[model samples]
Target chain A: MATTEAARPIAVATTPHRRTRWRHVLTGSVVPRVILIVSCLVFLAPFYWMVVSALKTNTELAQFPPSLIPGAWAFNNFPDAINYIPFGLYTFNSLVITVGATIGAVLSNTLVAYGFSRIQWPGRNALFYLCVATIFLPYPVILVALFDIFGRLPSFGIQGAKSWVDTFLPLIVPAFFGNPFYIFLMRQFMLGIPKELSDAAKVDGASELQTFWRVILPLTRPAVIVVLILAAVAAWNEFLLPLLYLQSNDKYPLAVGLIFFTSEHDVSYNLLMAASTLIVLPVVIIFLVAQRFFIEGITVGGVKG
Target chain B: MTAAATSVKPRSVGRFRLGTLERRNLKWGLLFISPWAFGFIALGVFPILYTFFLSLTRYTGFRSPTLIGFNNYTTMWNDPDFWKAAYNTLYYTVLAVPIGVVVAMLLAIAMNQKVREVAIYRAIFYLPSILPVFAISFVFVVLLNPGYGLVNLLLTTAGLPSPNWLGDPAYTKLALVMIAQLGAGQWALVFLAGLRGIPIELYESAEIDGAGAFRRFRSITLPLMTPVILYDIIIGLSFGLQVFTSAYILTGGATRGGAGPDNSLLTYVFYLYQQAFQFGSMGYAAALSVVLFLASVILAMAVFRWARGWVFYGGEEA
Candidate 1:
């Protein structure tokens, strides 16, 4: 077999334009175009409102007849948002948690997933199924217990009786042990790699680890990229775990940090909206920059099952 | 010489005996995968088994769980809210999941069209999925705020009476279901990928066999895509049962008060959150969690069993 080949010429063939006259009239007609425009508007409306609200002052935003666009674009609102919360600290905290967790998860889960997919080790299937089955276990169920477990670790002399909540232990440690979802994704991707490639590597006197590192790892970069994007997005959007575990205001991620600013006493809608807009900016930019790779990664690796 | 070497069998101790290299690889594999396996057995499996045991007991946060022998299970039998929560969840799942799958599939199929400006369109459609649920929730609240809300405003303009969306019990679930489906970007992309997987030759052959578009989809497309559909169904169902943040946030968090008006939007997870954190009934909340777990496992196992009948593999028989 012509396996271990780095690249193959992709044959691009255009989709046949088999649009019959009636079929074209029915689907490619003006009516469908109008509907599409309307649908697009419906989809875009909420996002537009978020942007518009973020830019408007409280009085302007709270008006009876809603403003489609802000009267005077309050460019200051974005700057005001920074002071609304300890935005810098929150961003830093979020960065530490997301980056650390994603890096750890990708590293750990890839190795575990690779082991399961490539090796015919004993109890592997049972272990993989165990991981899959745990996918349905609600986090809330084990959270209190996990906290208890974390609390007792002073016996091991790690934290010296400090609550794990104040530290990034809860968010960071669970990730170092492979996440089930990422493991599943990596396993799927690994399975798709032809066995012949690895066999050929072995025939050339390569060990399993060498084949994994030099051959498989390099080849599965797309899947790894996908995992990275997913891990980052998941860590970013994560709220419940952070709120449950992280205690100090300074230690808060952006998602949880913003909540403190919107408490009942001074729920400044303008500032809240501005902060919300700012919180989403990083994610939006990341999405845009990695648009092609992200979609391919998610659709191919993450989304399948 | 190479042909002769290939023809010769590899030297081995015996069929039952492992070579040093193979043993080393196996040991290395175990070492490499130890984190997951250890975590699984230690954290995952232990907690699950412990929780199963704990569900039978009345354990508060600080105390040892005393076994009550199905007292919790009996309580669920009589608890109106248990049934109510189940009904509400099932209602939401039924309305949301299929509509979500269909709408997502349709959106994917539509976006898969050959057109310029498609990337922007894709981004526009997918924007909601990545945007924080908080942002979307706030936007929806403002947009569906009964009086000055855009949706109600439009409804009133069309001479139709507008109902309270998040406020009223009758429309609360419907409103949630509708809003939930709005974030179909991820699912749409998945379906789009699955759509690409169906061999063009199969569709073309169906067309040549005088099958109409609908017929071709039903016969060839649906059968081939059954695995993806099954996967989505399981995932959608699991996620549907865990509807918390939206309902919790919409009800203005625990501090704002209990789940939306008349407990209309009180999902199982939301209710569990209330009981455990807000009400300080950790024991009761843990029981509820177990109940939710059981429900999810049963549903998942059912889907898996059903997959044996309907989900078509590429080469394997169902």
Candidate 2:
């Protein structure tokens, strides 16, 4: 990918006269572009339909053949959808979990990754391998046991909580434990930082913690951002864990809450779409704004595998 | 500094003597990783081991457990619903993974094209992937509505029979498979990265040798992409086996045990969830978890073992 990026400017620089011809040739090959355009449309059709349906009146939604565009723009449906359920409460719950998880993920993963990467300790490589191996272990294998463990949290005498079940603790607390994927990603990123920087910090009489905080962590901003975005997205989108752990309707995250909205008696299709659109909006905005991080994070993790 | 010291005087490991520096390094390393280590033990290893222990005992959440030997496993062996869930999960994996890989590869190829609007195309393709699956499931419910859903409406316009996607048991799993394709863009990005990693010179040289595009792709692109494909297959298998959310939402809720019409959407994880939470068969659920873990590990190993035959490394020996 880097090589392709590097080659393009050079090609244009050296063959300035042929650039127009090259552009013409590129544009003249229409089949690939047509296929791409059509595929993009196919890919986006559902979202387009979703937005269109969200704007439709109930009568229009009940039409024999749904209109491509809504007959009347039912803008009130968004507010109505939110009012129908505890959308605000669900959004708040989702935010709390997402924010909590992201913070934990960033802190734990960075620290753990530093240990795995920067330090030269005996058994480090073997331990890092063990951490990475955990990535392959099916999460469902531990679900039942984790549920049991969290369910017993009240017995452990934690303050201000009856049980970890029916609370955000199960969803939020796990992020404080380093995820193997993020650890691996951060470790890879940390390894690329020059050892001399850390050595220099040490020579200047800084502690290992100080060296990490002041020197290494600053240089790791991009990787940290990647972890943050990925963790936030995962936390926001997480379903099974939250579904299992959270019992109260008022405490439900948007992911779980949306299902409840759909299961209501005689669900208004337009209102459902409106709520779905609302739930999807933040993620779409985040992806658009931080597109590079999303692509880079996934590709980097995948390519190294 | 420490790395340089280690390089100069490689420590003798047979006796395993630790110097002051080594001890300090070890202490700091352990300190830095304490959170993860604690988590690994508490959340990961302990849970896994406890799951195994739980699988052997009959326990409800509210009551004490009684040792049942391997009765849960034995029961699972004879249970028709367990087999149905297993089959549904397998059927979904067999279809979804390969289809996802192909769709992703095709999308990757399209994205790799030197089109002016490639970034926009890439964004459009990937947009659906990052959206919450639950929301997507809701959208799918409306889109796959039998009477006037977008999918069936399109099928009708194209002069094809529009089957009940969510209603019919035969089509329920198939509907989930179609929904799974929406997330192919995530893997497509990986494939795109792999495609980019292939040296352009290989194609240029192949062009000079009078090899057609198909020949170039077969000999060069496909072989080089086998590793990424293998990665995708392994990841896809794990995800495919654990599929729950869409099915859970589509089939009303956990109250319905997440089993769609005629149990078509009763995926392995869904079944396990139902067993543990809904039915209060914690022991049986634990057993299901154990089998799922074993299946994931064995299947992953099998893929790796098979990959040895076909996956090509650029410079390293396979």
* lDDT tens digits, residue span B49-157, model 2: 9999999999998777788999999999999999999999999999999999999998888777766677887788788888888878878888888877888888999
Candidate 1 at residue A258, lDDT?
70
> What is candidate 1's lDDT per residue for B208-302, written digit by digit as tens?
68787689768887787788777777777887888877776677664577678888888887777666656655556667878887788888898
Q: What TM-score against the true fold does each predicted structure earn?
A: 0.87, 0.92
The runs of at least 3 residues in candidate 1 whose Cα sits more than 4 Å from the true structure, single-residue gaps closed, are A1-22, A28-37, A122-126, A136-138, A155-161, A192-211, A301-305, B1-21, B63-67, B114-117, B306-310
> By how many angstroms RMSD does model 1 differ from the true structure?
6.0
Model 2 misplaced stretches (Cα beyond 4 Å): A1-28, A155-161, A303-305, B1-15, B255-258
> For residues A78-192, what per-residue lDDT tens digits would candidate 1 score against the true structure?
8888986888988998899999888888898889988888876667788788787666655565554565455445433323426564577778877788878778878888889
Query: In model 2, how large is the Cα lDDT of residue A245?
Result: 84
In model 2, residue pairs whose N, Cα or C atoms come closer than 3 Å (at least 3 residues apart or on different chains), thus clashing, are: none
